[model samples]
Target: MSTHLCSPQHVLVLNCGSSSLKFAILDATTSDEVISGLAERLGSDTPSIKYKYNGEKQLIELAKGQAHDAAIAELVKLVNELGLADNLIAVGHRVVHGGEHFTESVLIDDNVLTAIEKTAALAPLHNPANLLGIRTAQQAFSTLPQIAVFDTAFHQTMPNIAYLYALPYSLYKEHGVRRYGFHGTSHYYVAGEAAKLLGKEREQTNVISAHLGNGCSVCAIKDGKSVDTSMGLTPLEGLVMGTRSGSIDPGLFTFLTQQLNYSVQEIDDLLNKQSGLLGISELSNDCRTIEEAAVEGHPQANLALDIFCYRLAKQIAAFLVPVQRLDALIFTGGIGENSDIIRDKVITQLGFLGLECDEAANLAARFGKEGLISKGQAHAKAFVIPTNEEWVIANDAARIAKEG
Candidate 1:
């Protein structure tokens, strides 16, 4: 499917959501994308499949509203028609939570599938969809291997001090209720890229990576391994996100229950769905909208952004304890890679650490471009390195499948 000659290893990666699915065929060796597609509004009134292949974009409408089974079937048919089945060496599925069972990417077997199912309760919304994608992909590529890449796998190296909860020891032992970070694939990708920029081997590198997007988390990497991260047992425990009220006070839950007569579900919905920039600004959840509104001197918009940047700056500074000497500070993700204002605001707050934003450099790194957004002579610099999680997944799939 690639415009050029196909590499020896190509992987079909699937990242499934409850009502949507994203897929891509990538050359693992060269990190080049061959085919990319998104299926949205599945099992609804009007479902649609949008894809890019052979350097052209196309869309297919499903009037009857196809579910996962039918949508996956259509995708498999498209791949077969394009003659990419034989070119694909493995199928990689992105599983959001491995729940301590998985520490790294692995070739999926019956045991792995069962283990993934067992952990579904921990990620009630994500793991099941991930499993569905894997199961369907297994049916389509019966003879080929199916591999799994997890969002929590890279942070499995964190010590007890970084992941343990103080509430109760029994809660963690009986229910596995300890911190398990998310966005591992993104963090791992950028950390390696940051190491490359610093001209140091990964094992010799120490840095903090802020993955600011619709979902945000800050990771502290000490000598190539994740030592600490802001996210806890769930993705809702870190920096303020587009919708999630990250790291809220536990007492507020009780206060809402007693005072407002709010149920557990209502509280959950309020925090995860109606909070963050949308709640504070009383407007859109999108950062661009909030940033533009803030520039226009909207009071709530300015407050929302100010709080977001302050929290992010605090976490980035707190992570310094894990990796005492900062080699570099890295930013990646939708907002991190594009927003010069957010980046400058967060970095300038860390002036004590010798981090200073260079206006020209920061401005130049927007819209998917990569650049060092720090004063050239600063002892500790910052960078805008776009993450490539799919590349990491494809290569992991290729390597683990070969190990079999």
Candidate 2:
């Protein structure tokens, strides 16, 4: 095998979730996106793949009930059919849980694959699909290097005091259970971006990054390392998300099981798939719809929105205690990037922390751009920096491939 480095290489980044797959092609040398798209409803009645390149959108229809492998095969076909670069140097996959084994992005091999599989039980909904994507992509693009960028990698730096649960010592040791936070890629990226924007060295900056979307988590990043975070052993222990309950009393689970005759599976479904804003609103899981309902005087919808913001605000404050100086607070993800109302509410709630929002600046930030939302004289700065998890994954893949 040649040991020479490949320049101007193009790396493909893959983010495979439970029901969807998102892909991006990037120029490894410049770290700029060449094209990006998504294949959604992978195993549903209507599976559709959409690719956007050079301002052109192409949509492909797949047979209903197509699995993850089938979806990746179709995606590869689309990339080739579009006459995109064929010299794909590497591929990066977004694996949700790496447990305590992997603390950084790694080149994928049989041993690494096995380790990821062992961690699957911790992220039942994500790691399995991620493994499927990695395997399928490796087979489809034989001879190309593949890497795994874990969502739990950034939070691996968390201290024992922050990660340990208040449960039995036996549970911690016997079950390998602790606060292994998710959304590390986003938190890691935004914290660096925020420091750059603030004209400060990453090692000298302290930040709280809130990634709010279908799944949300807040991280306390000091000197560019995760000191504390909201998400726990799984992604379920964080701020209220689209359909997942954030925090709940453990006793409630036992009560629901014994008194209400609810099984463990039912309880799991309620906390993970059917709770959060959807369960509270009884209307929709999407924040936009819930916000609309709230605006129209719907009591439950309004209450749900309030609860979401309040809990998020309180959690953000909790993380601030770890940082000696809170340089900035950043918002990223779906709802955080687009919704001005939610941003405003959160800022208002954090006024005690010296966060004073410029209302006009807050409203001006939208459509995937970074901007400052804080008053110039505010003690702690606030920013809305859109996250690019795919870019991070691609960069890691390119570096690993080059090193080998």
Candidate 3:
């Protein structure tokens, strides 16, 4: 028989990016963040670490060419100095891609480390950094269990038809090439929150989750499970993002190579880093900046915003086909939660779906607050919910720790 778990403890959540590391300490019982910080520009000439504790901010400068190991050491030191190390029962790491291996958060071990390494090829820029953090934490706090909470794990519930591509069978069978969506943590968390807001059981909720930041993707959740998502094999395949050219014609590669004399690598870089909103505006990839410029009658900026909102709305509408009903349209992430202009413009395009935007609510919801922006007989309500991936990670880790 399953018994009640022990009292909650603090969990340290680590999220490692290509050049940055974000760390947080949270109380599992109360869902309160005790402390948080970010270490940026690692391996660059000017590296800095900034953290907040007890409402005070602190900064630390690093020597030239310092890397992940050094940054982690500093984090360990900070946690100890702040007297948070002993209460940290478990450490949770956010791993970007689990491929098809991990379906949920698991305790980190040698086998898990090996599997994460094997999946590195699928996420060149992320997995390695994540692995580094896992290893460093294992060494720094050897006694505590290190857990891996995957960003792709939540979407593993997707059906075969939704994930399989039209590529050759052998490529998929032999190379493990298929659509594995990103931002599953954010999607899952917000979906749960949306379900709560509606006072419905999670198994009965259906919502379209849009995560719009520098990297954007939309997820279709039917009955609390991800049925389909915009992002595919790589993060670069979804909605047009800050610099990513989402869902471009494959023919563009051949055309660029043949006519523009572009190499495969060069074309790859162009699409992955040079396109999207920045490509459209030829100014900035930031939505706020683009919005300001558009208000000033900048043609390209207006065009950029239009294309982003229109494409996003179309994708949201398309996702509706997979669900039994639409309960809510959730907006999370940087722009999704904060930018009323972007939210209003996207909802304007989604008028056909009966989503009406309440201007006051839309404007009121900013900087990590929740707001229901739809009104009066709308088929589905629209919301702005701030995502807390670190909280999810901490809770997952705490559960695993208690189970053991």
lDDT (10s digit) by residue, model 3, range 1-404: 10112334899899998889999989887788888999999999999899987779999998998978899899888877766776888999999999999999998888999999999999998999999888888899899999999999989999999999999989889988999999999999999999999999989999999999999999999999999999998899979899999998898888999999999889878988899999999998898899999999999999999999889988999998888589999999999998999999998888888888899999999999998998879768999999999999999999999888
Better of 1 and 3 by TM-score: 1
Candidate 1 wrong stretches, greater than 4 Å: 1-5
> Which ranges in model 3 have alpha carbons more than 4 Å from their true place?
1-8
From the highest lDDT down, the ranking of the candidates is 1, 3, 2
TM-score of 3: 0.97
Write down the lDDT that model 2 would get.
0.89
Q: TM-scores, in order shown?
A: 0.98, 0.96, 0.97
Model 2: which ten-residue window has the lowest total lDDT? 1-10
Candidate 3: which pairs clash?
none
RMSD of each: 1.2, 3.1, 3.4
TM-score of 1: 0.98
Q: Candidate 2: where are CA atoms >4 Å away?
A: 1-7
What's the number of clashes in each of the models?
0, 0, 0
Ranking by TM-score: 1, 3, 2
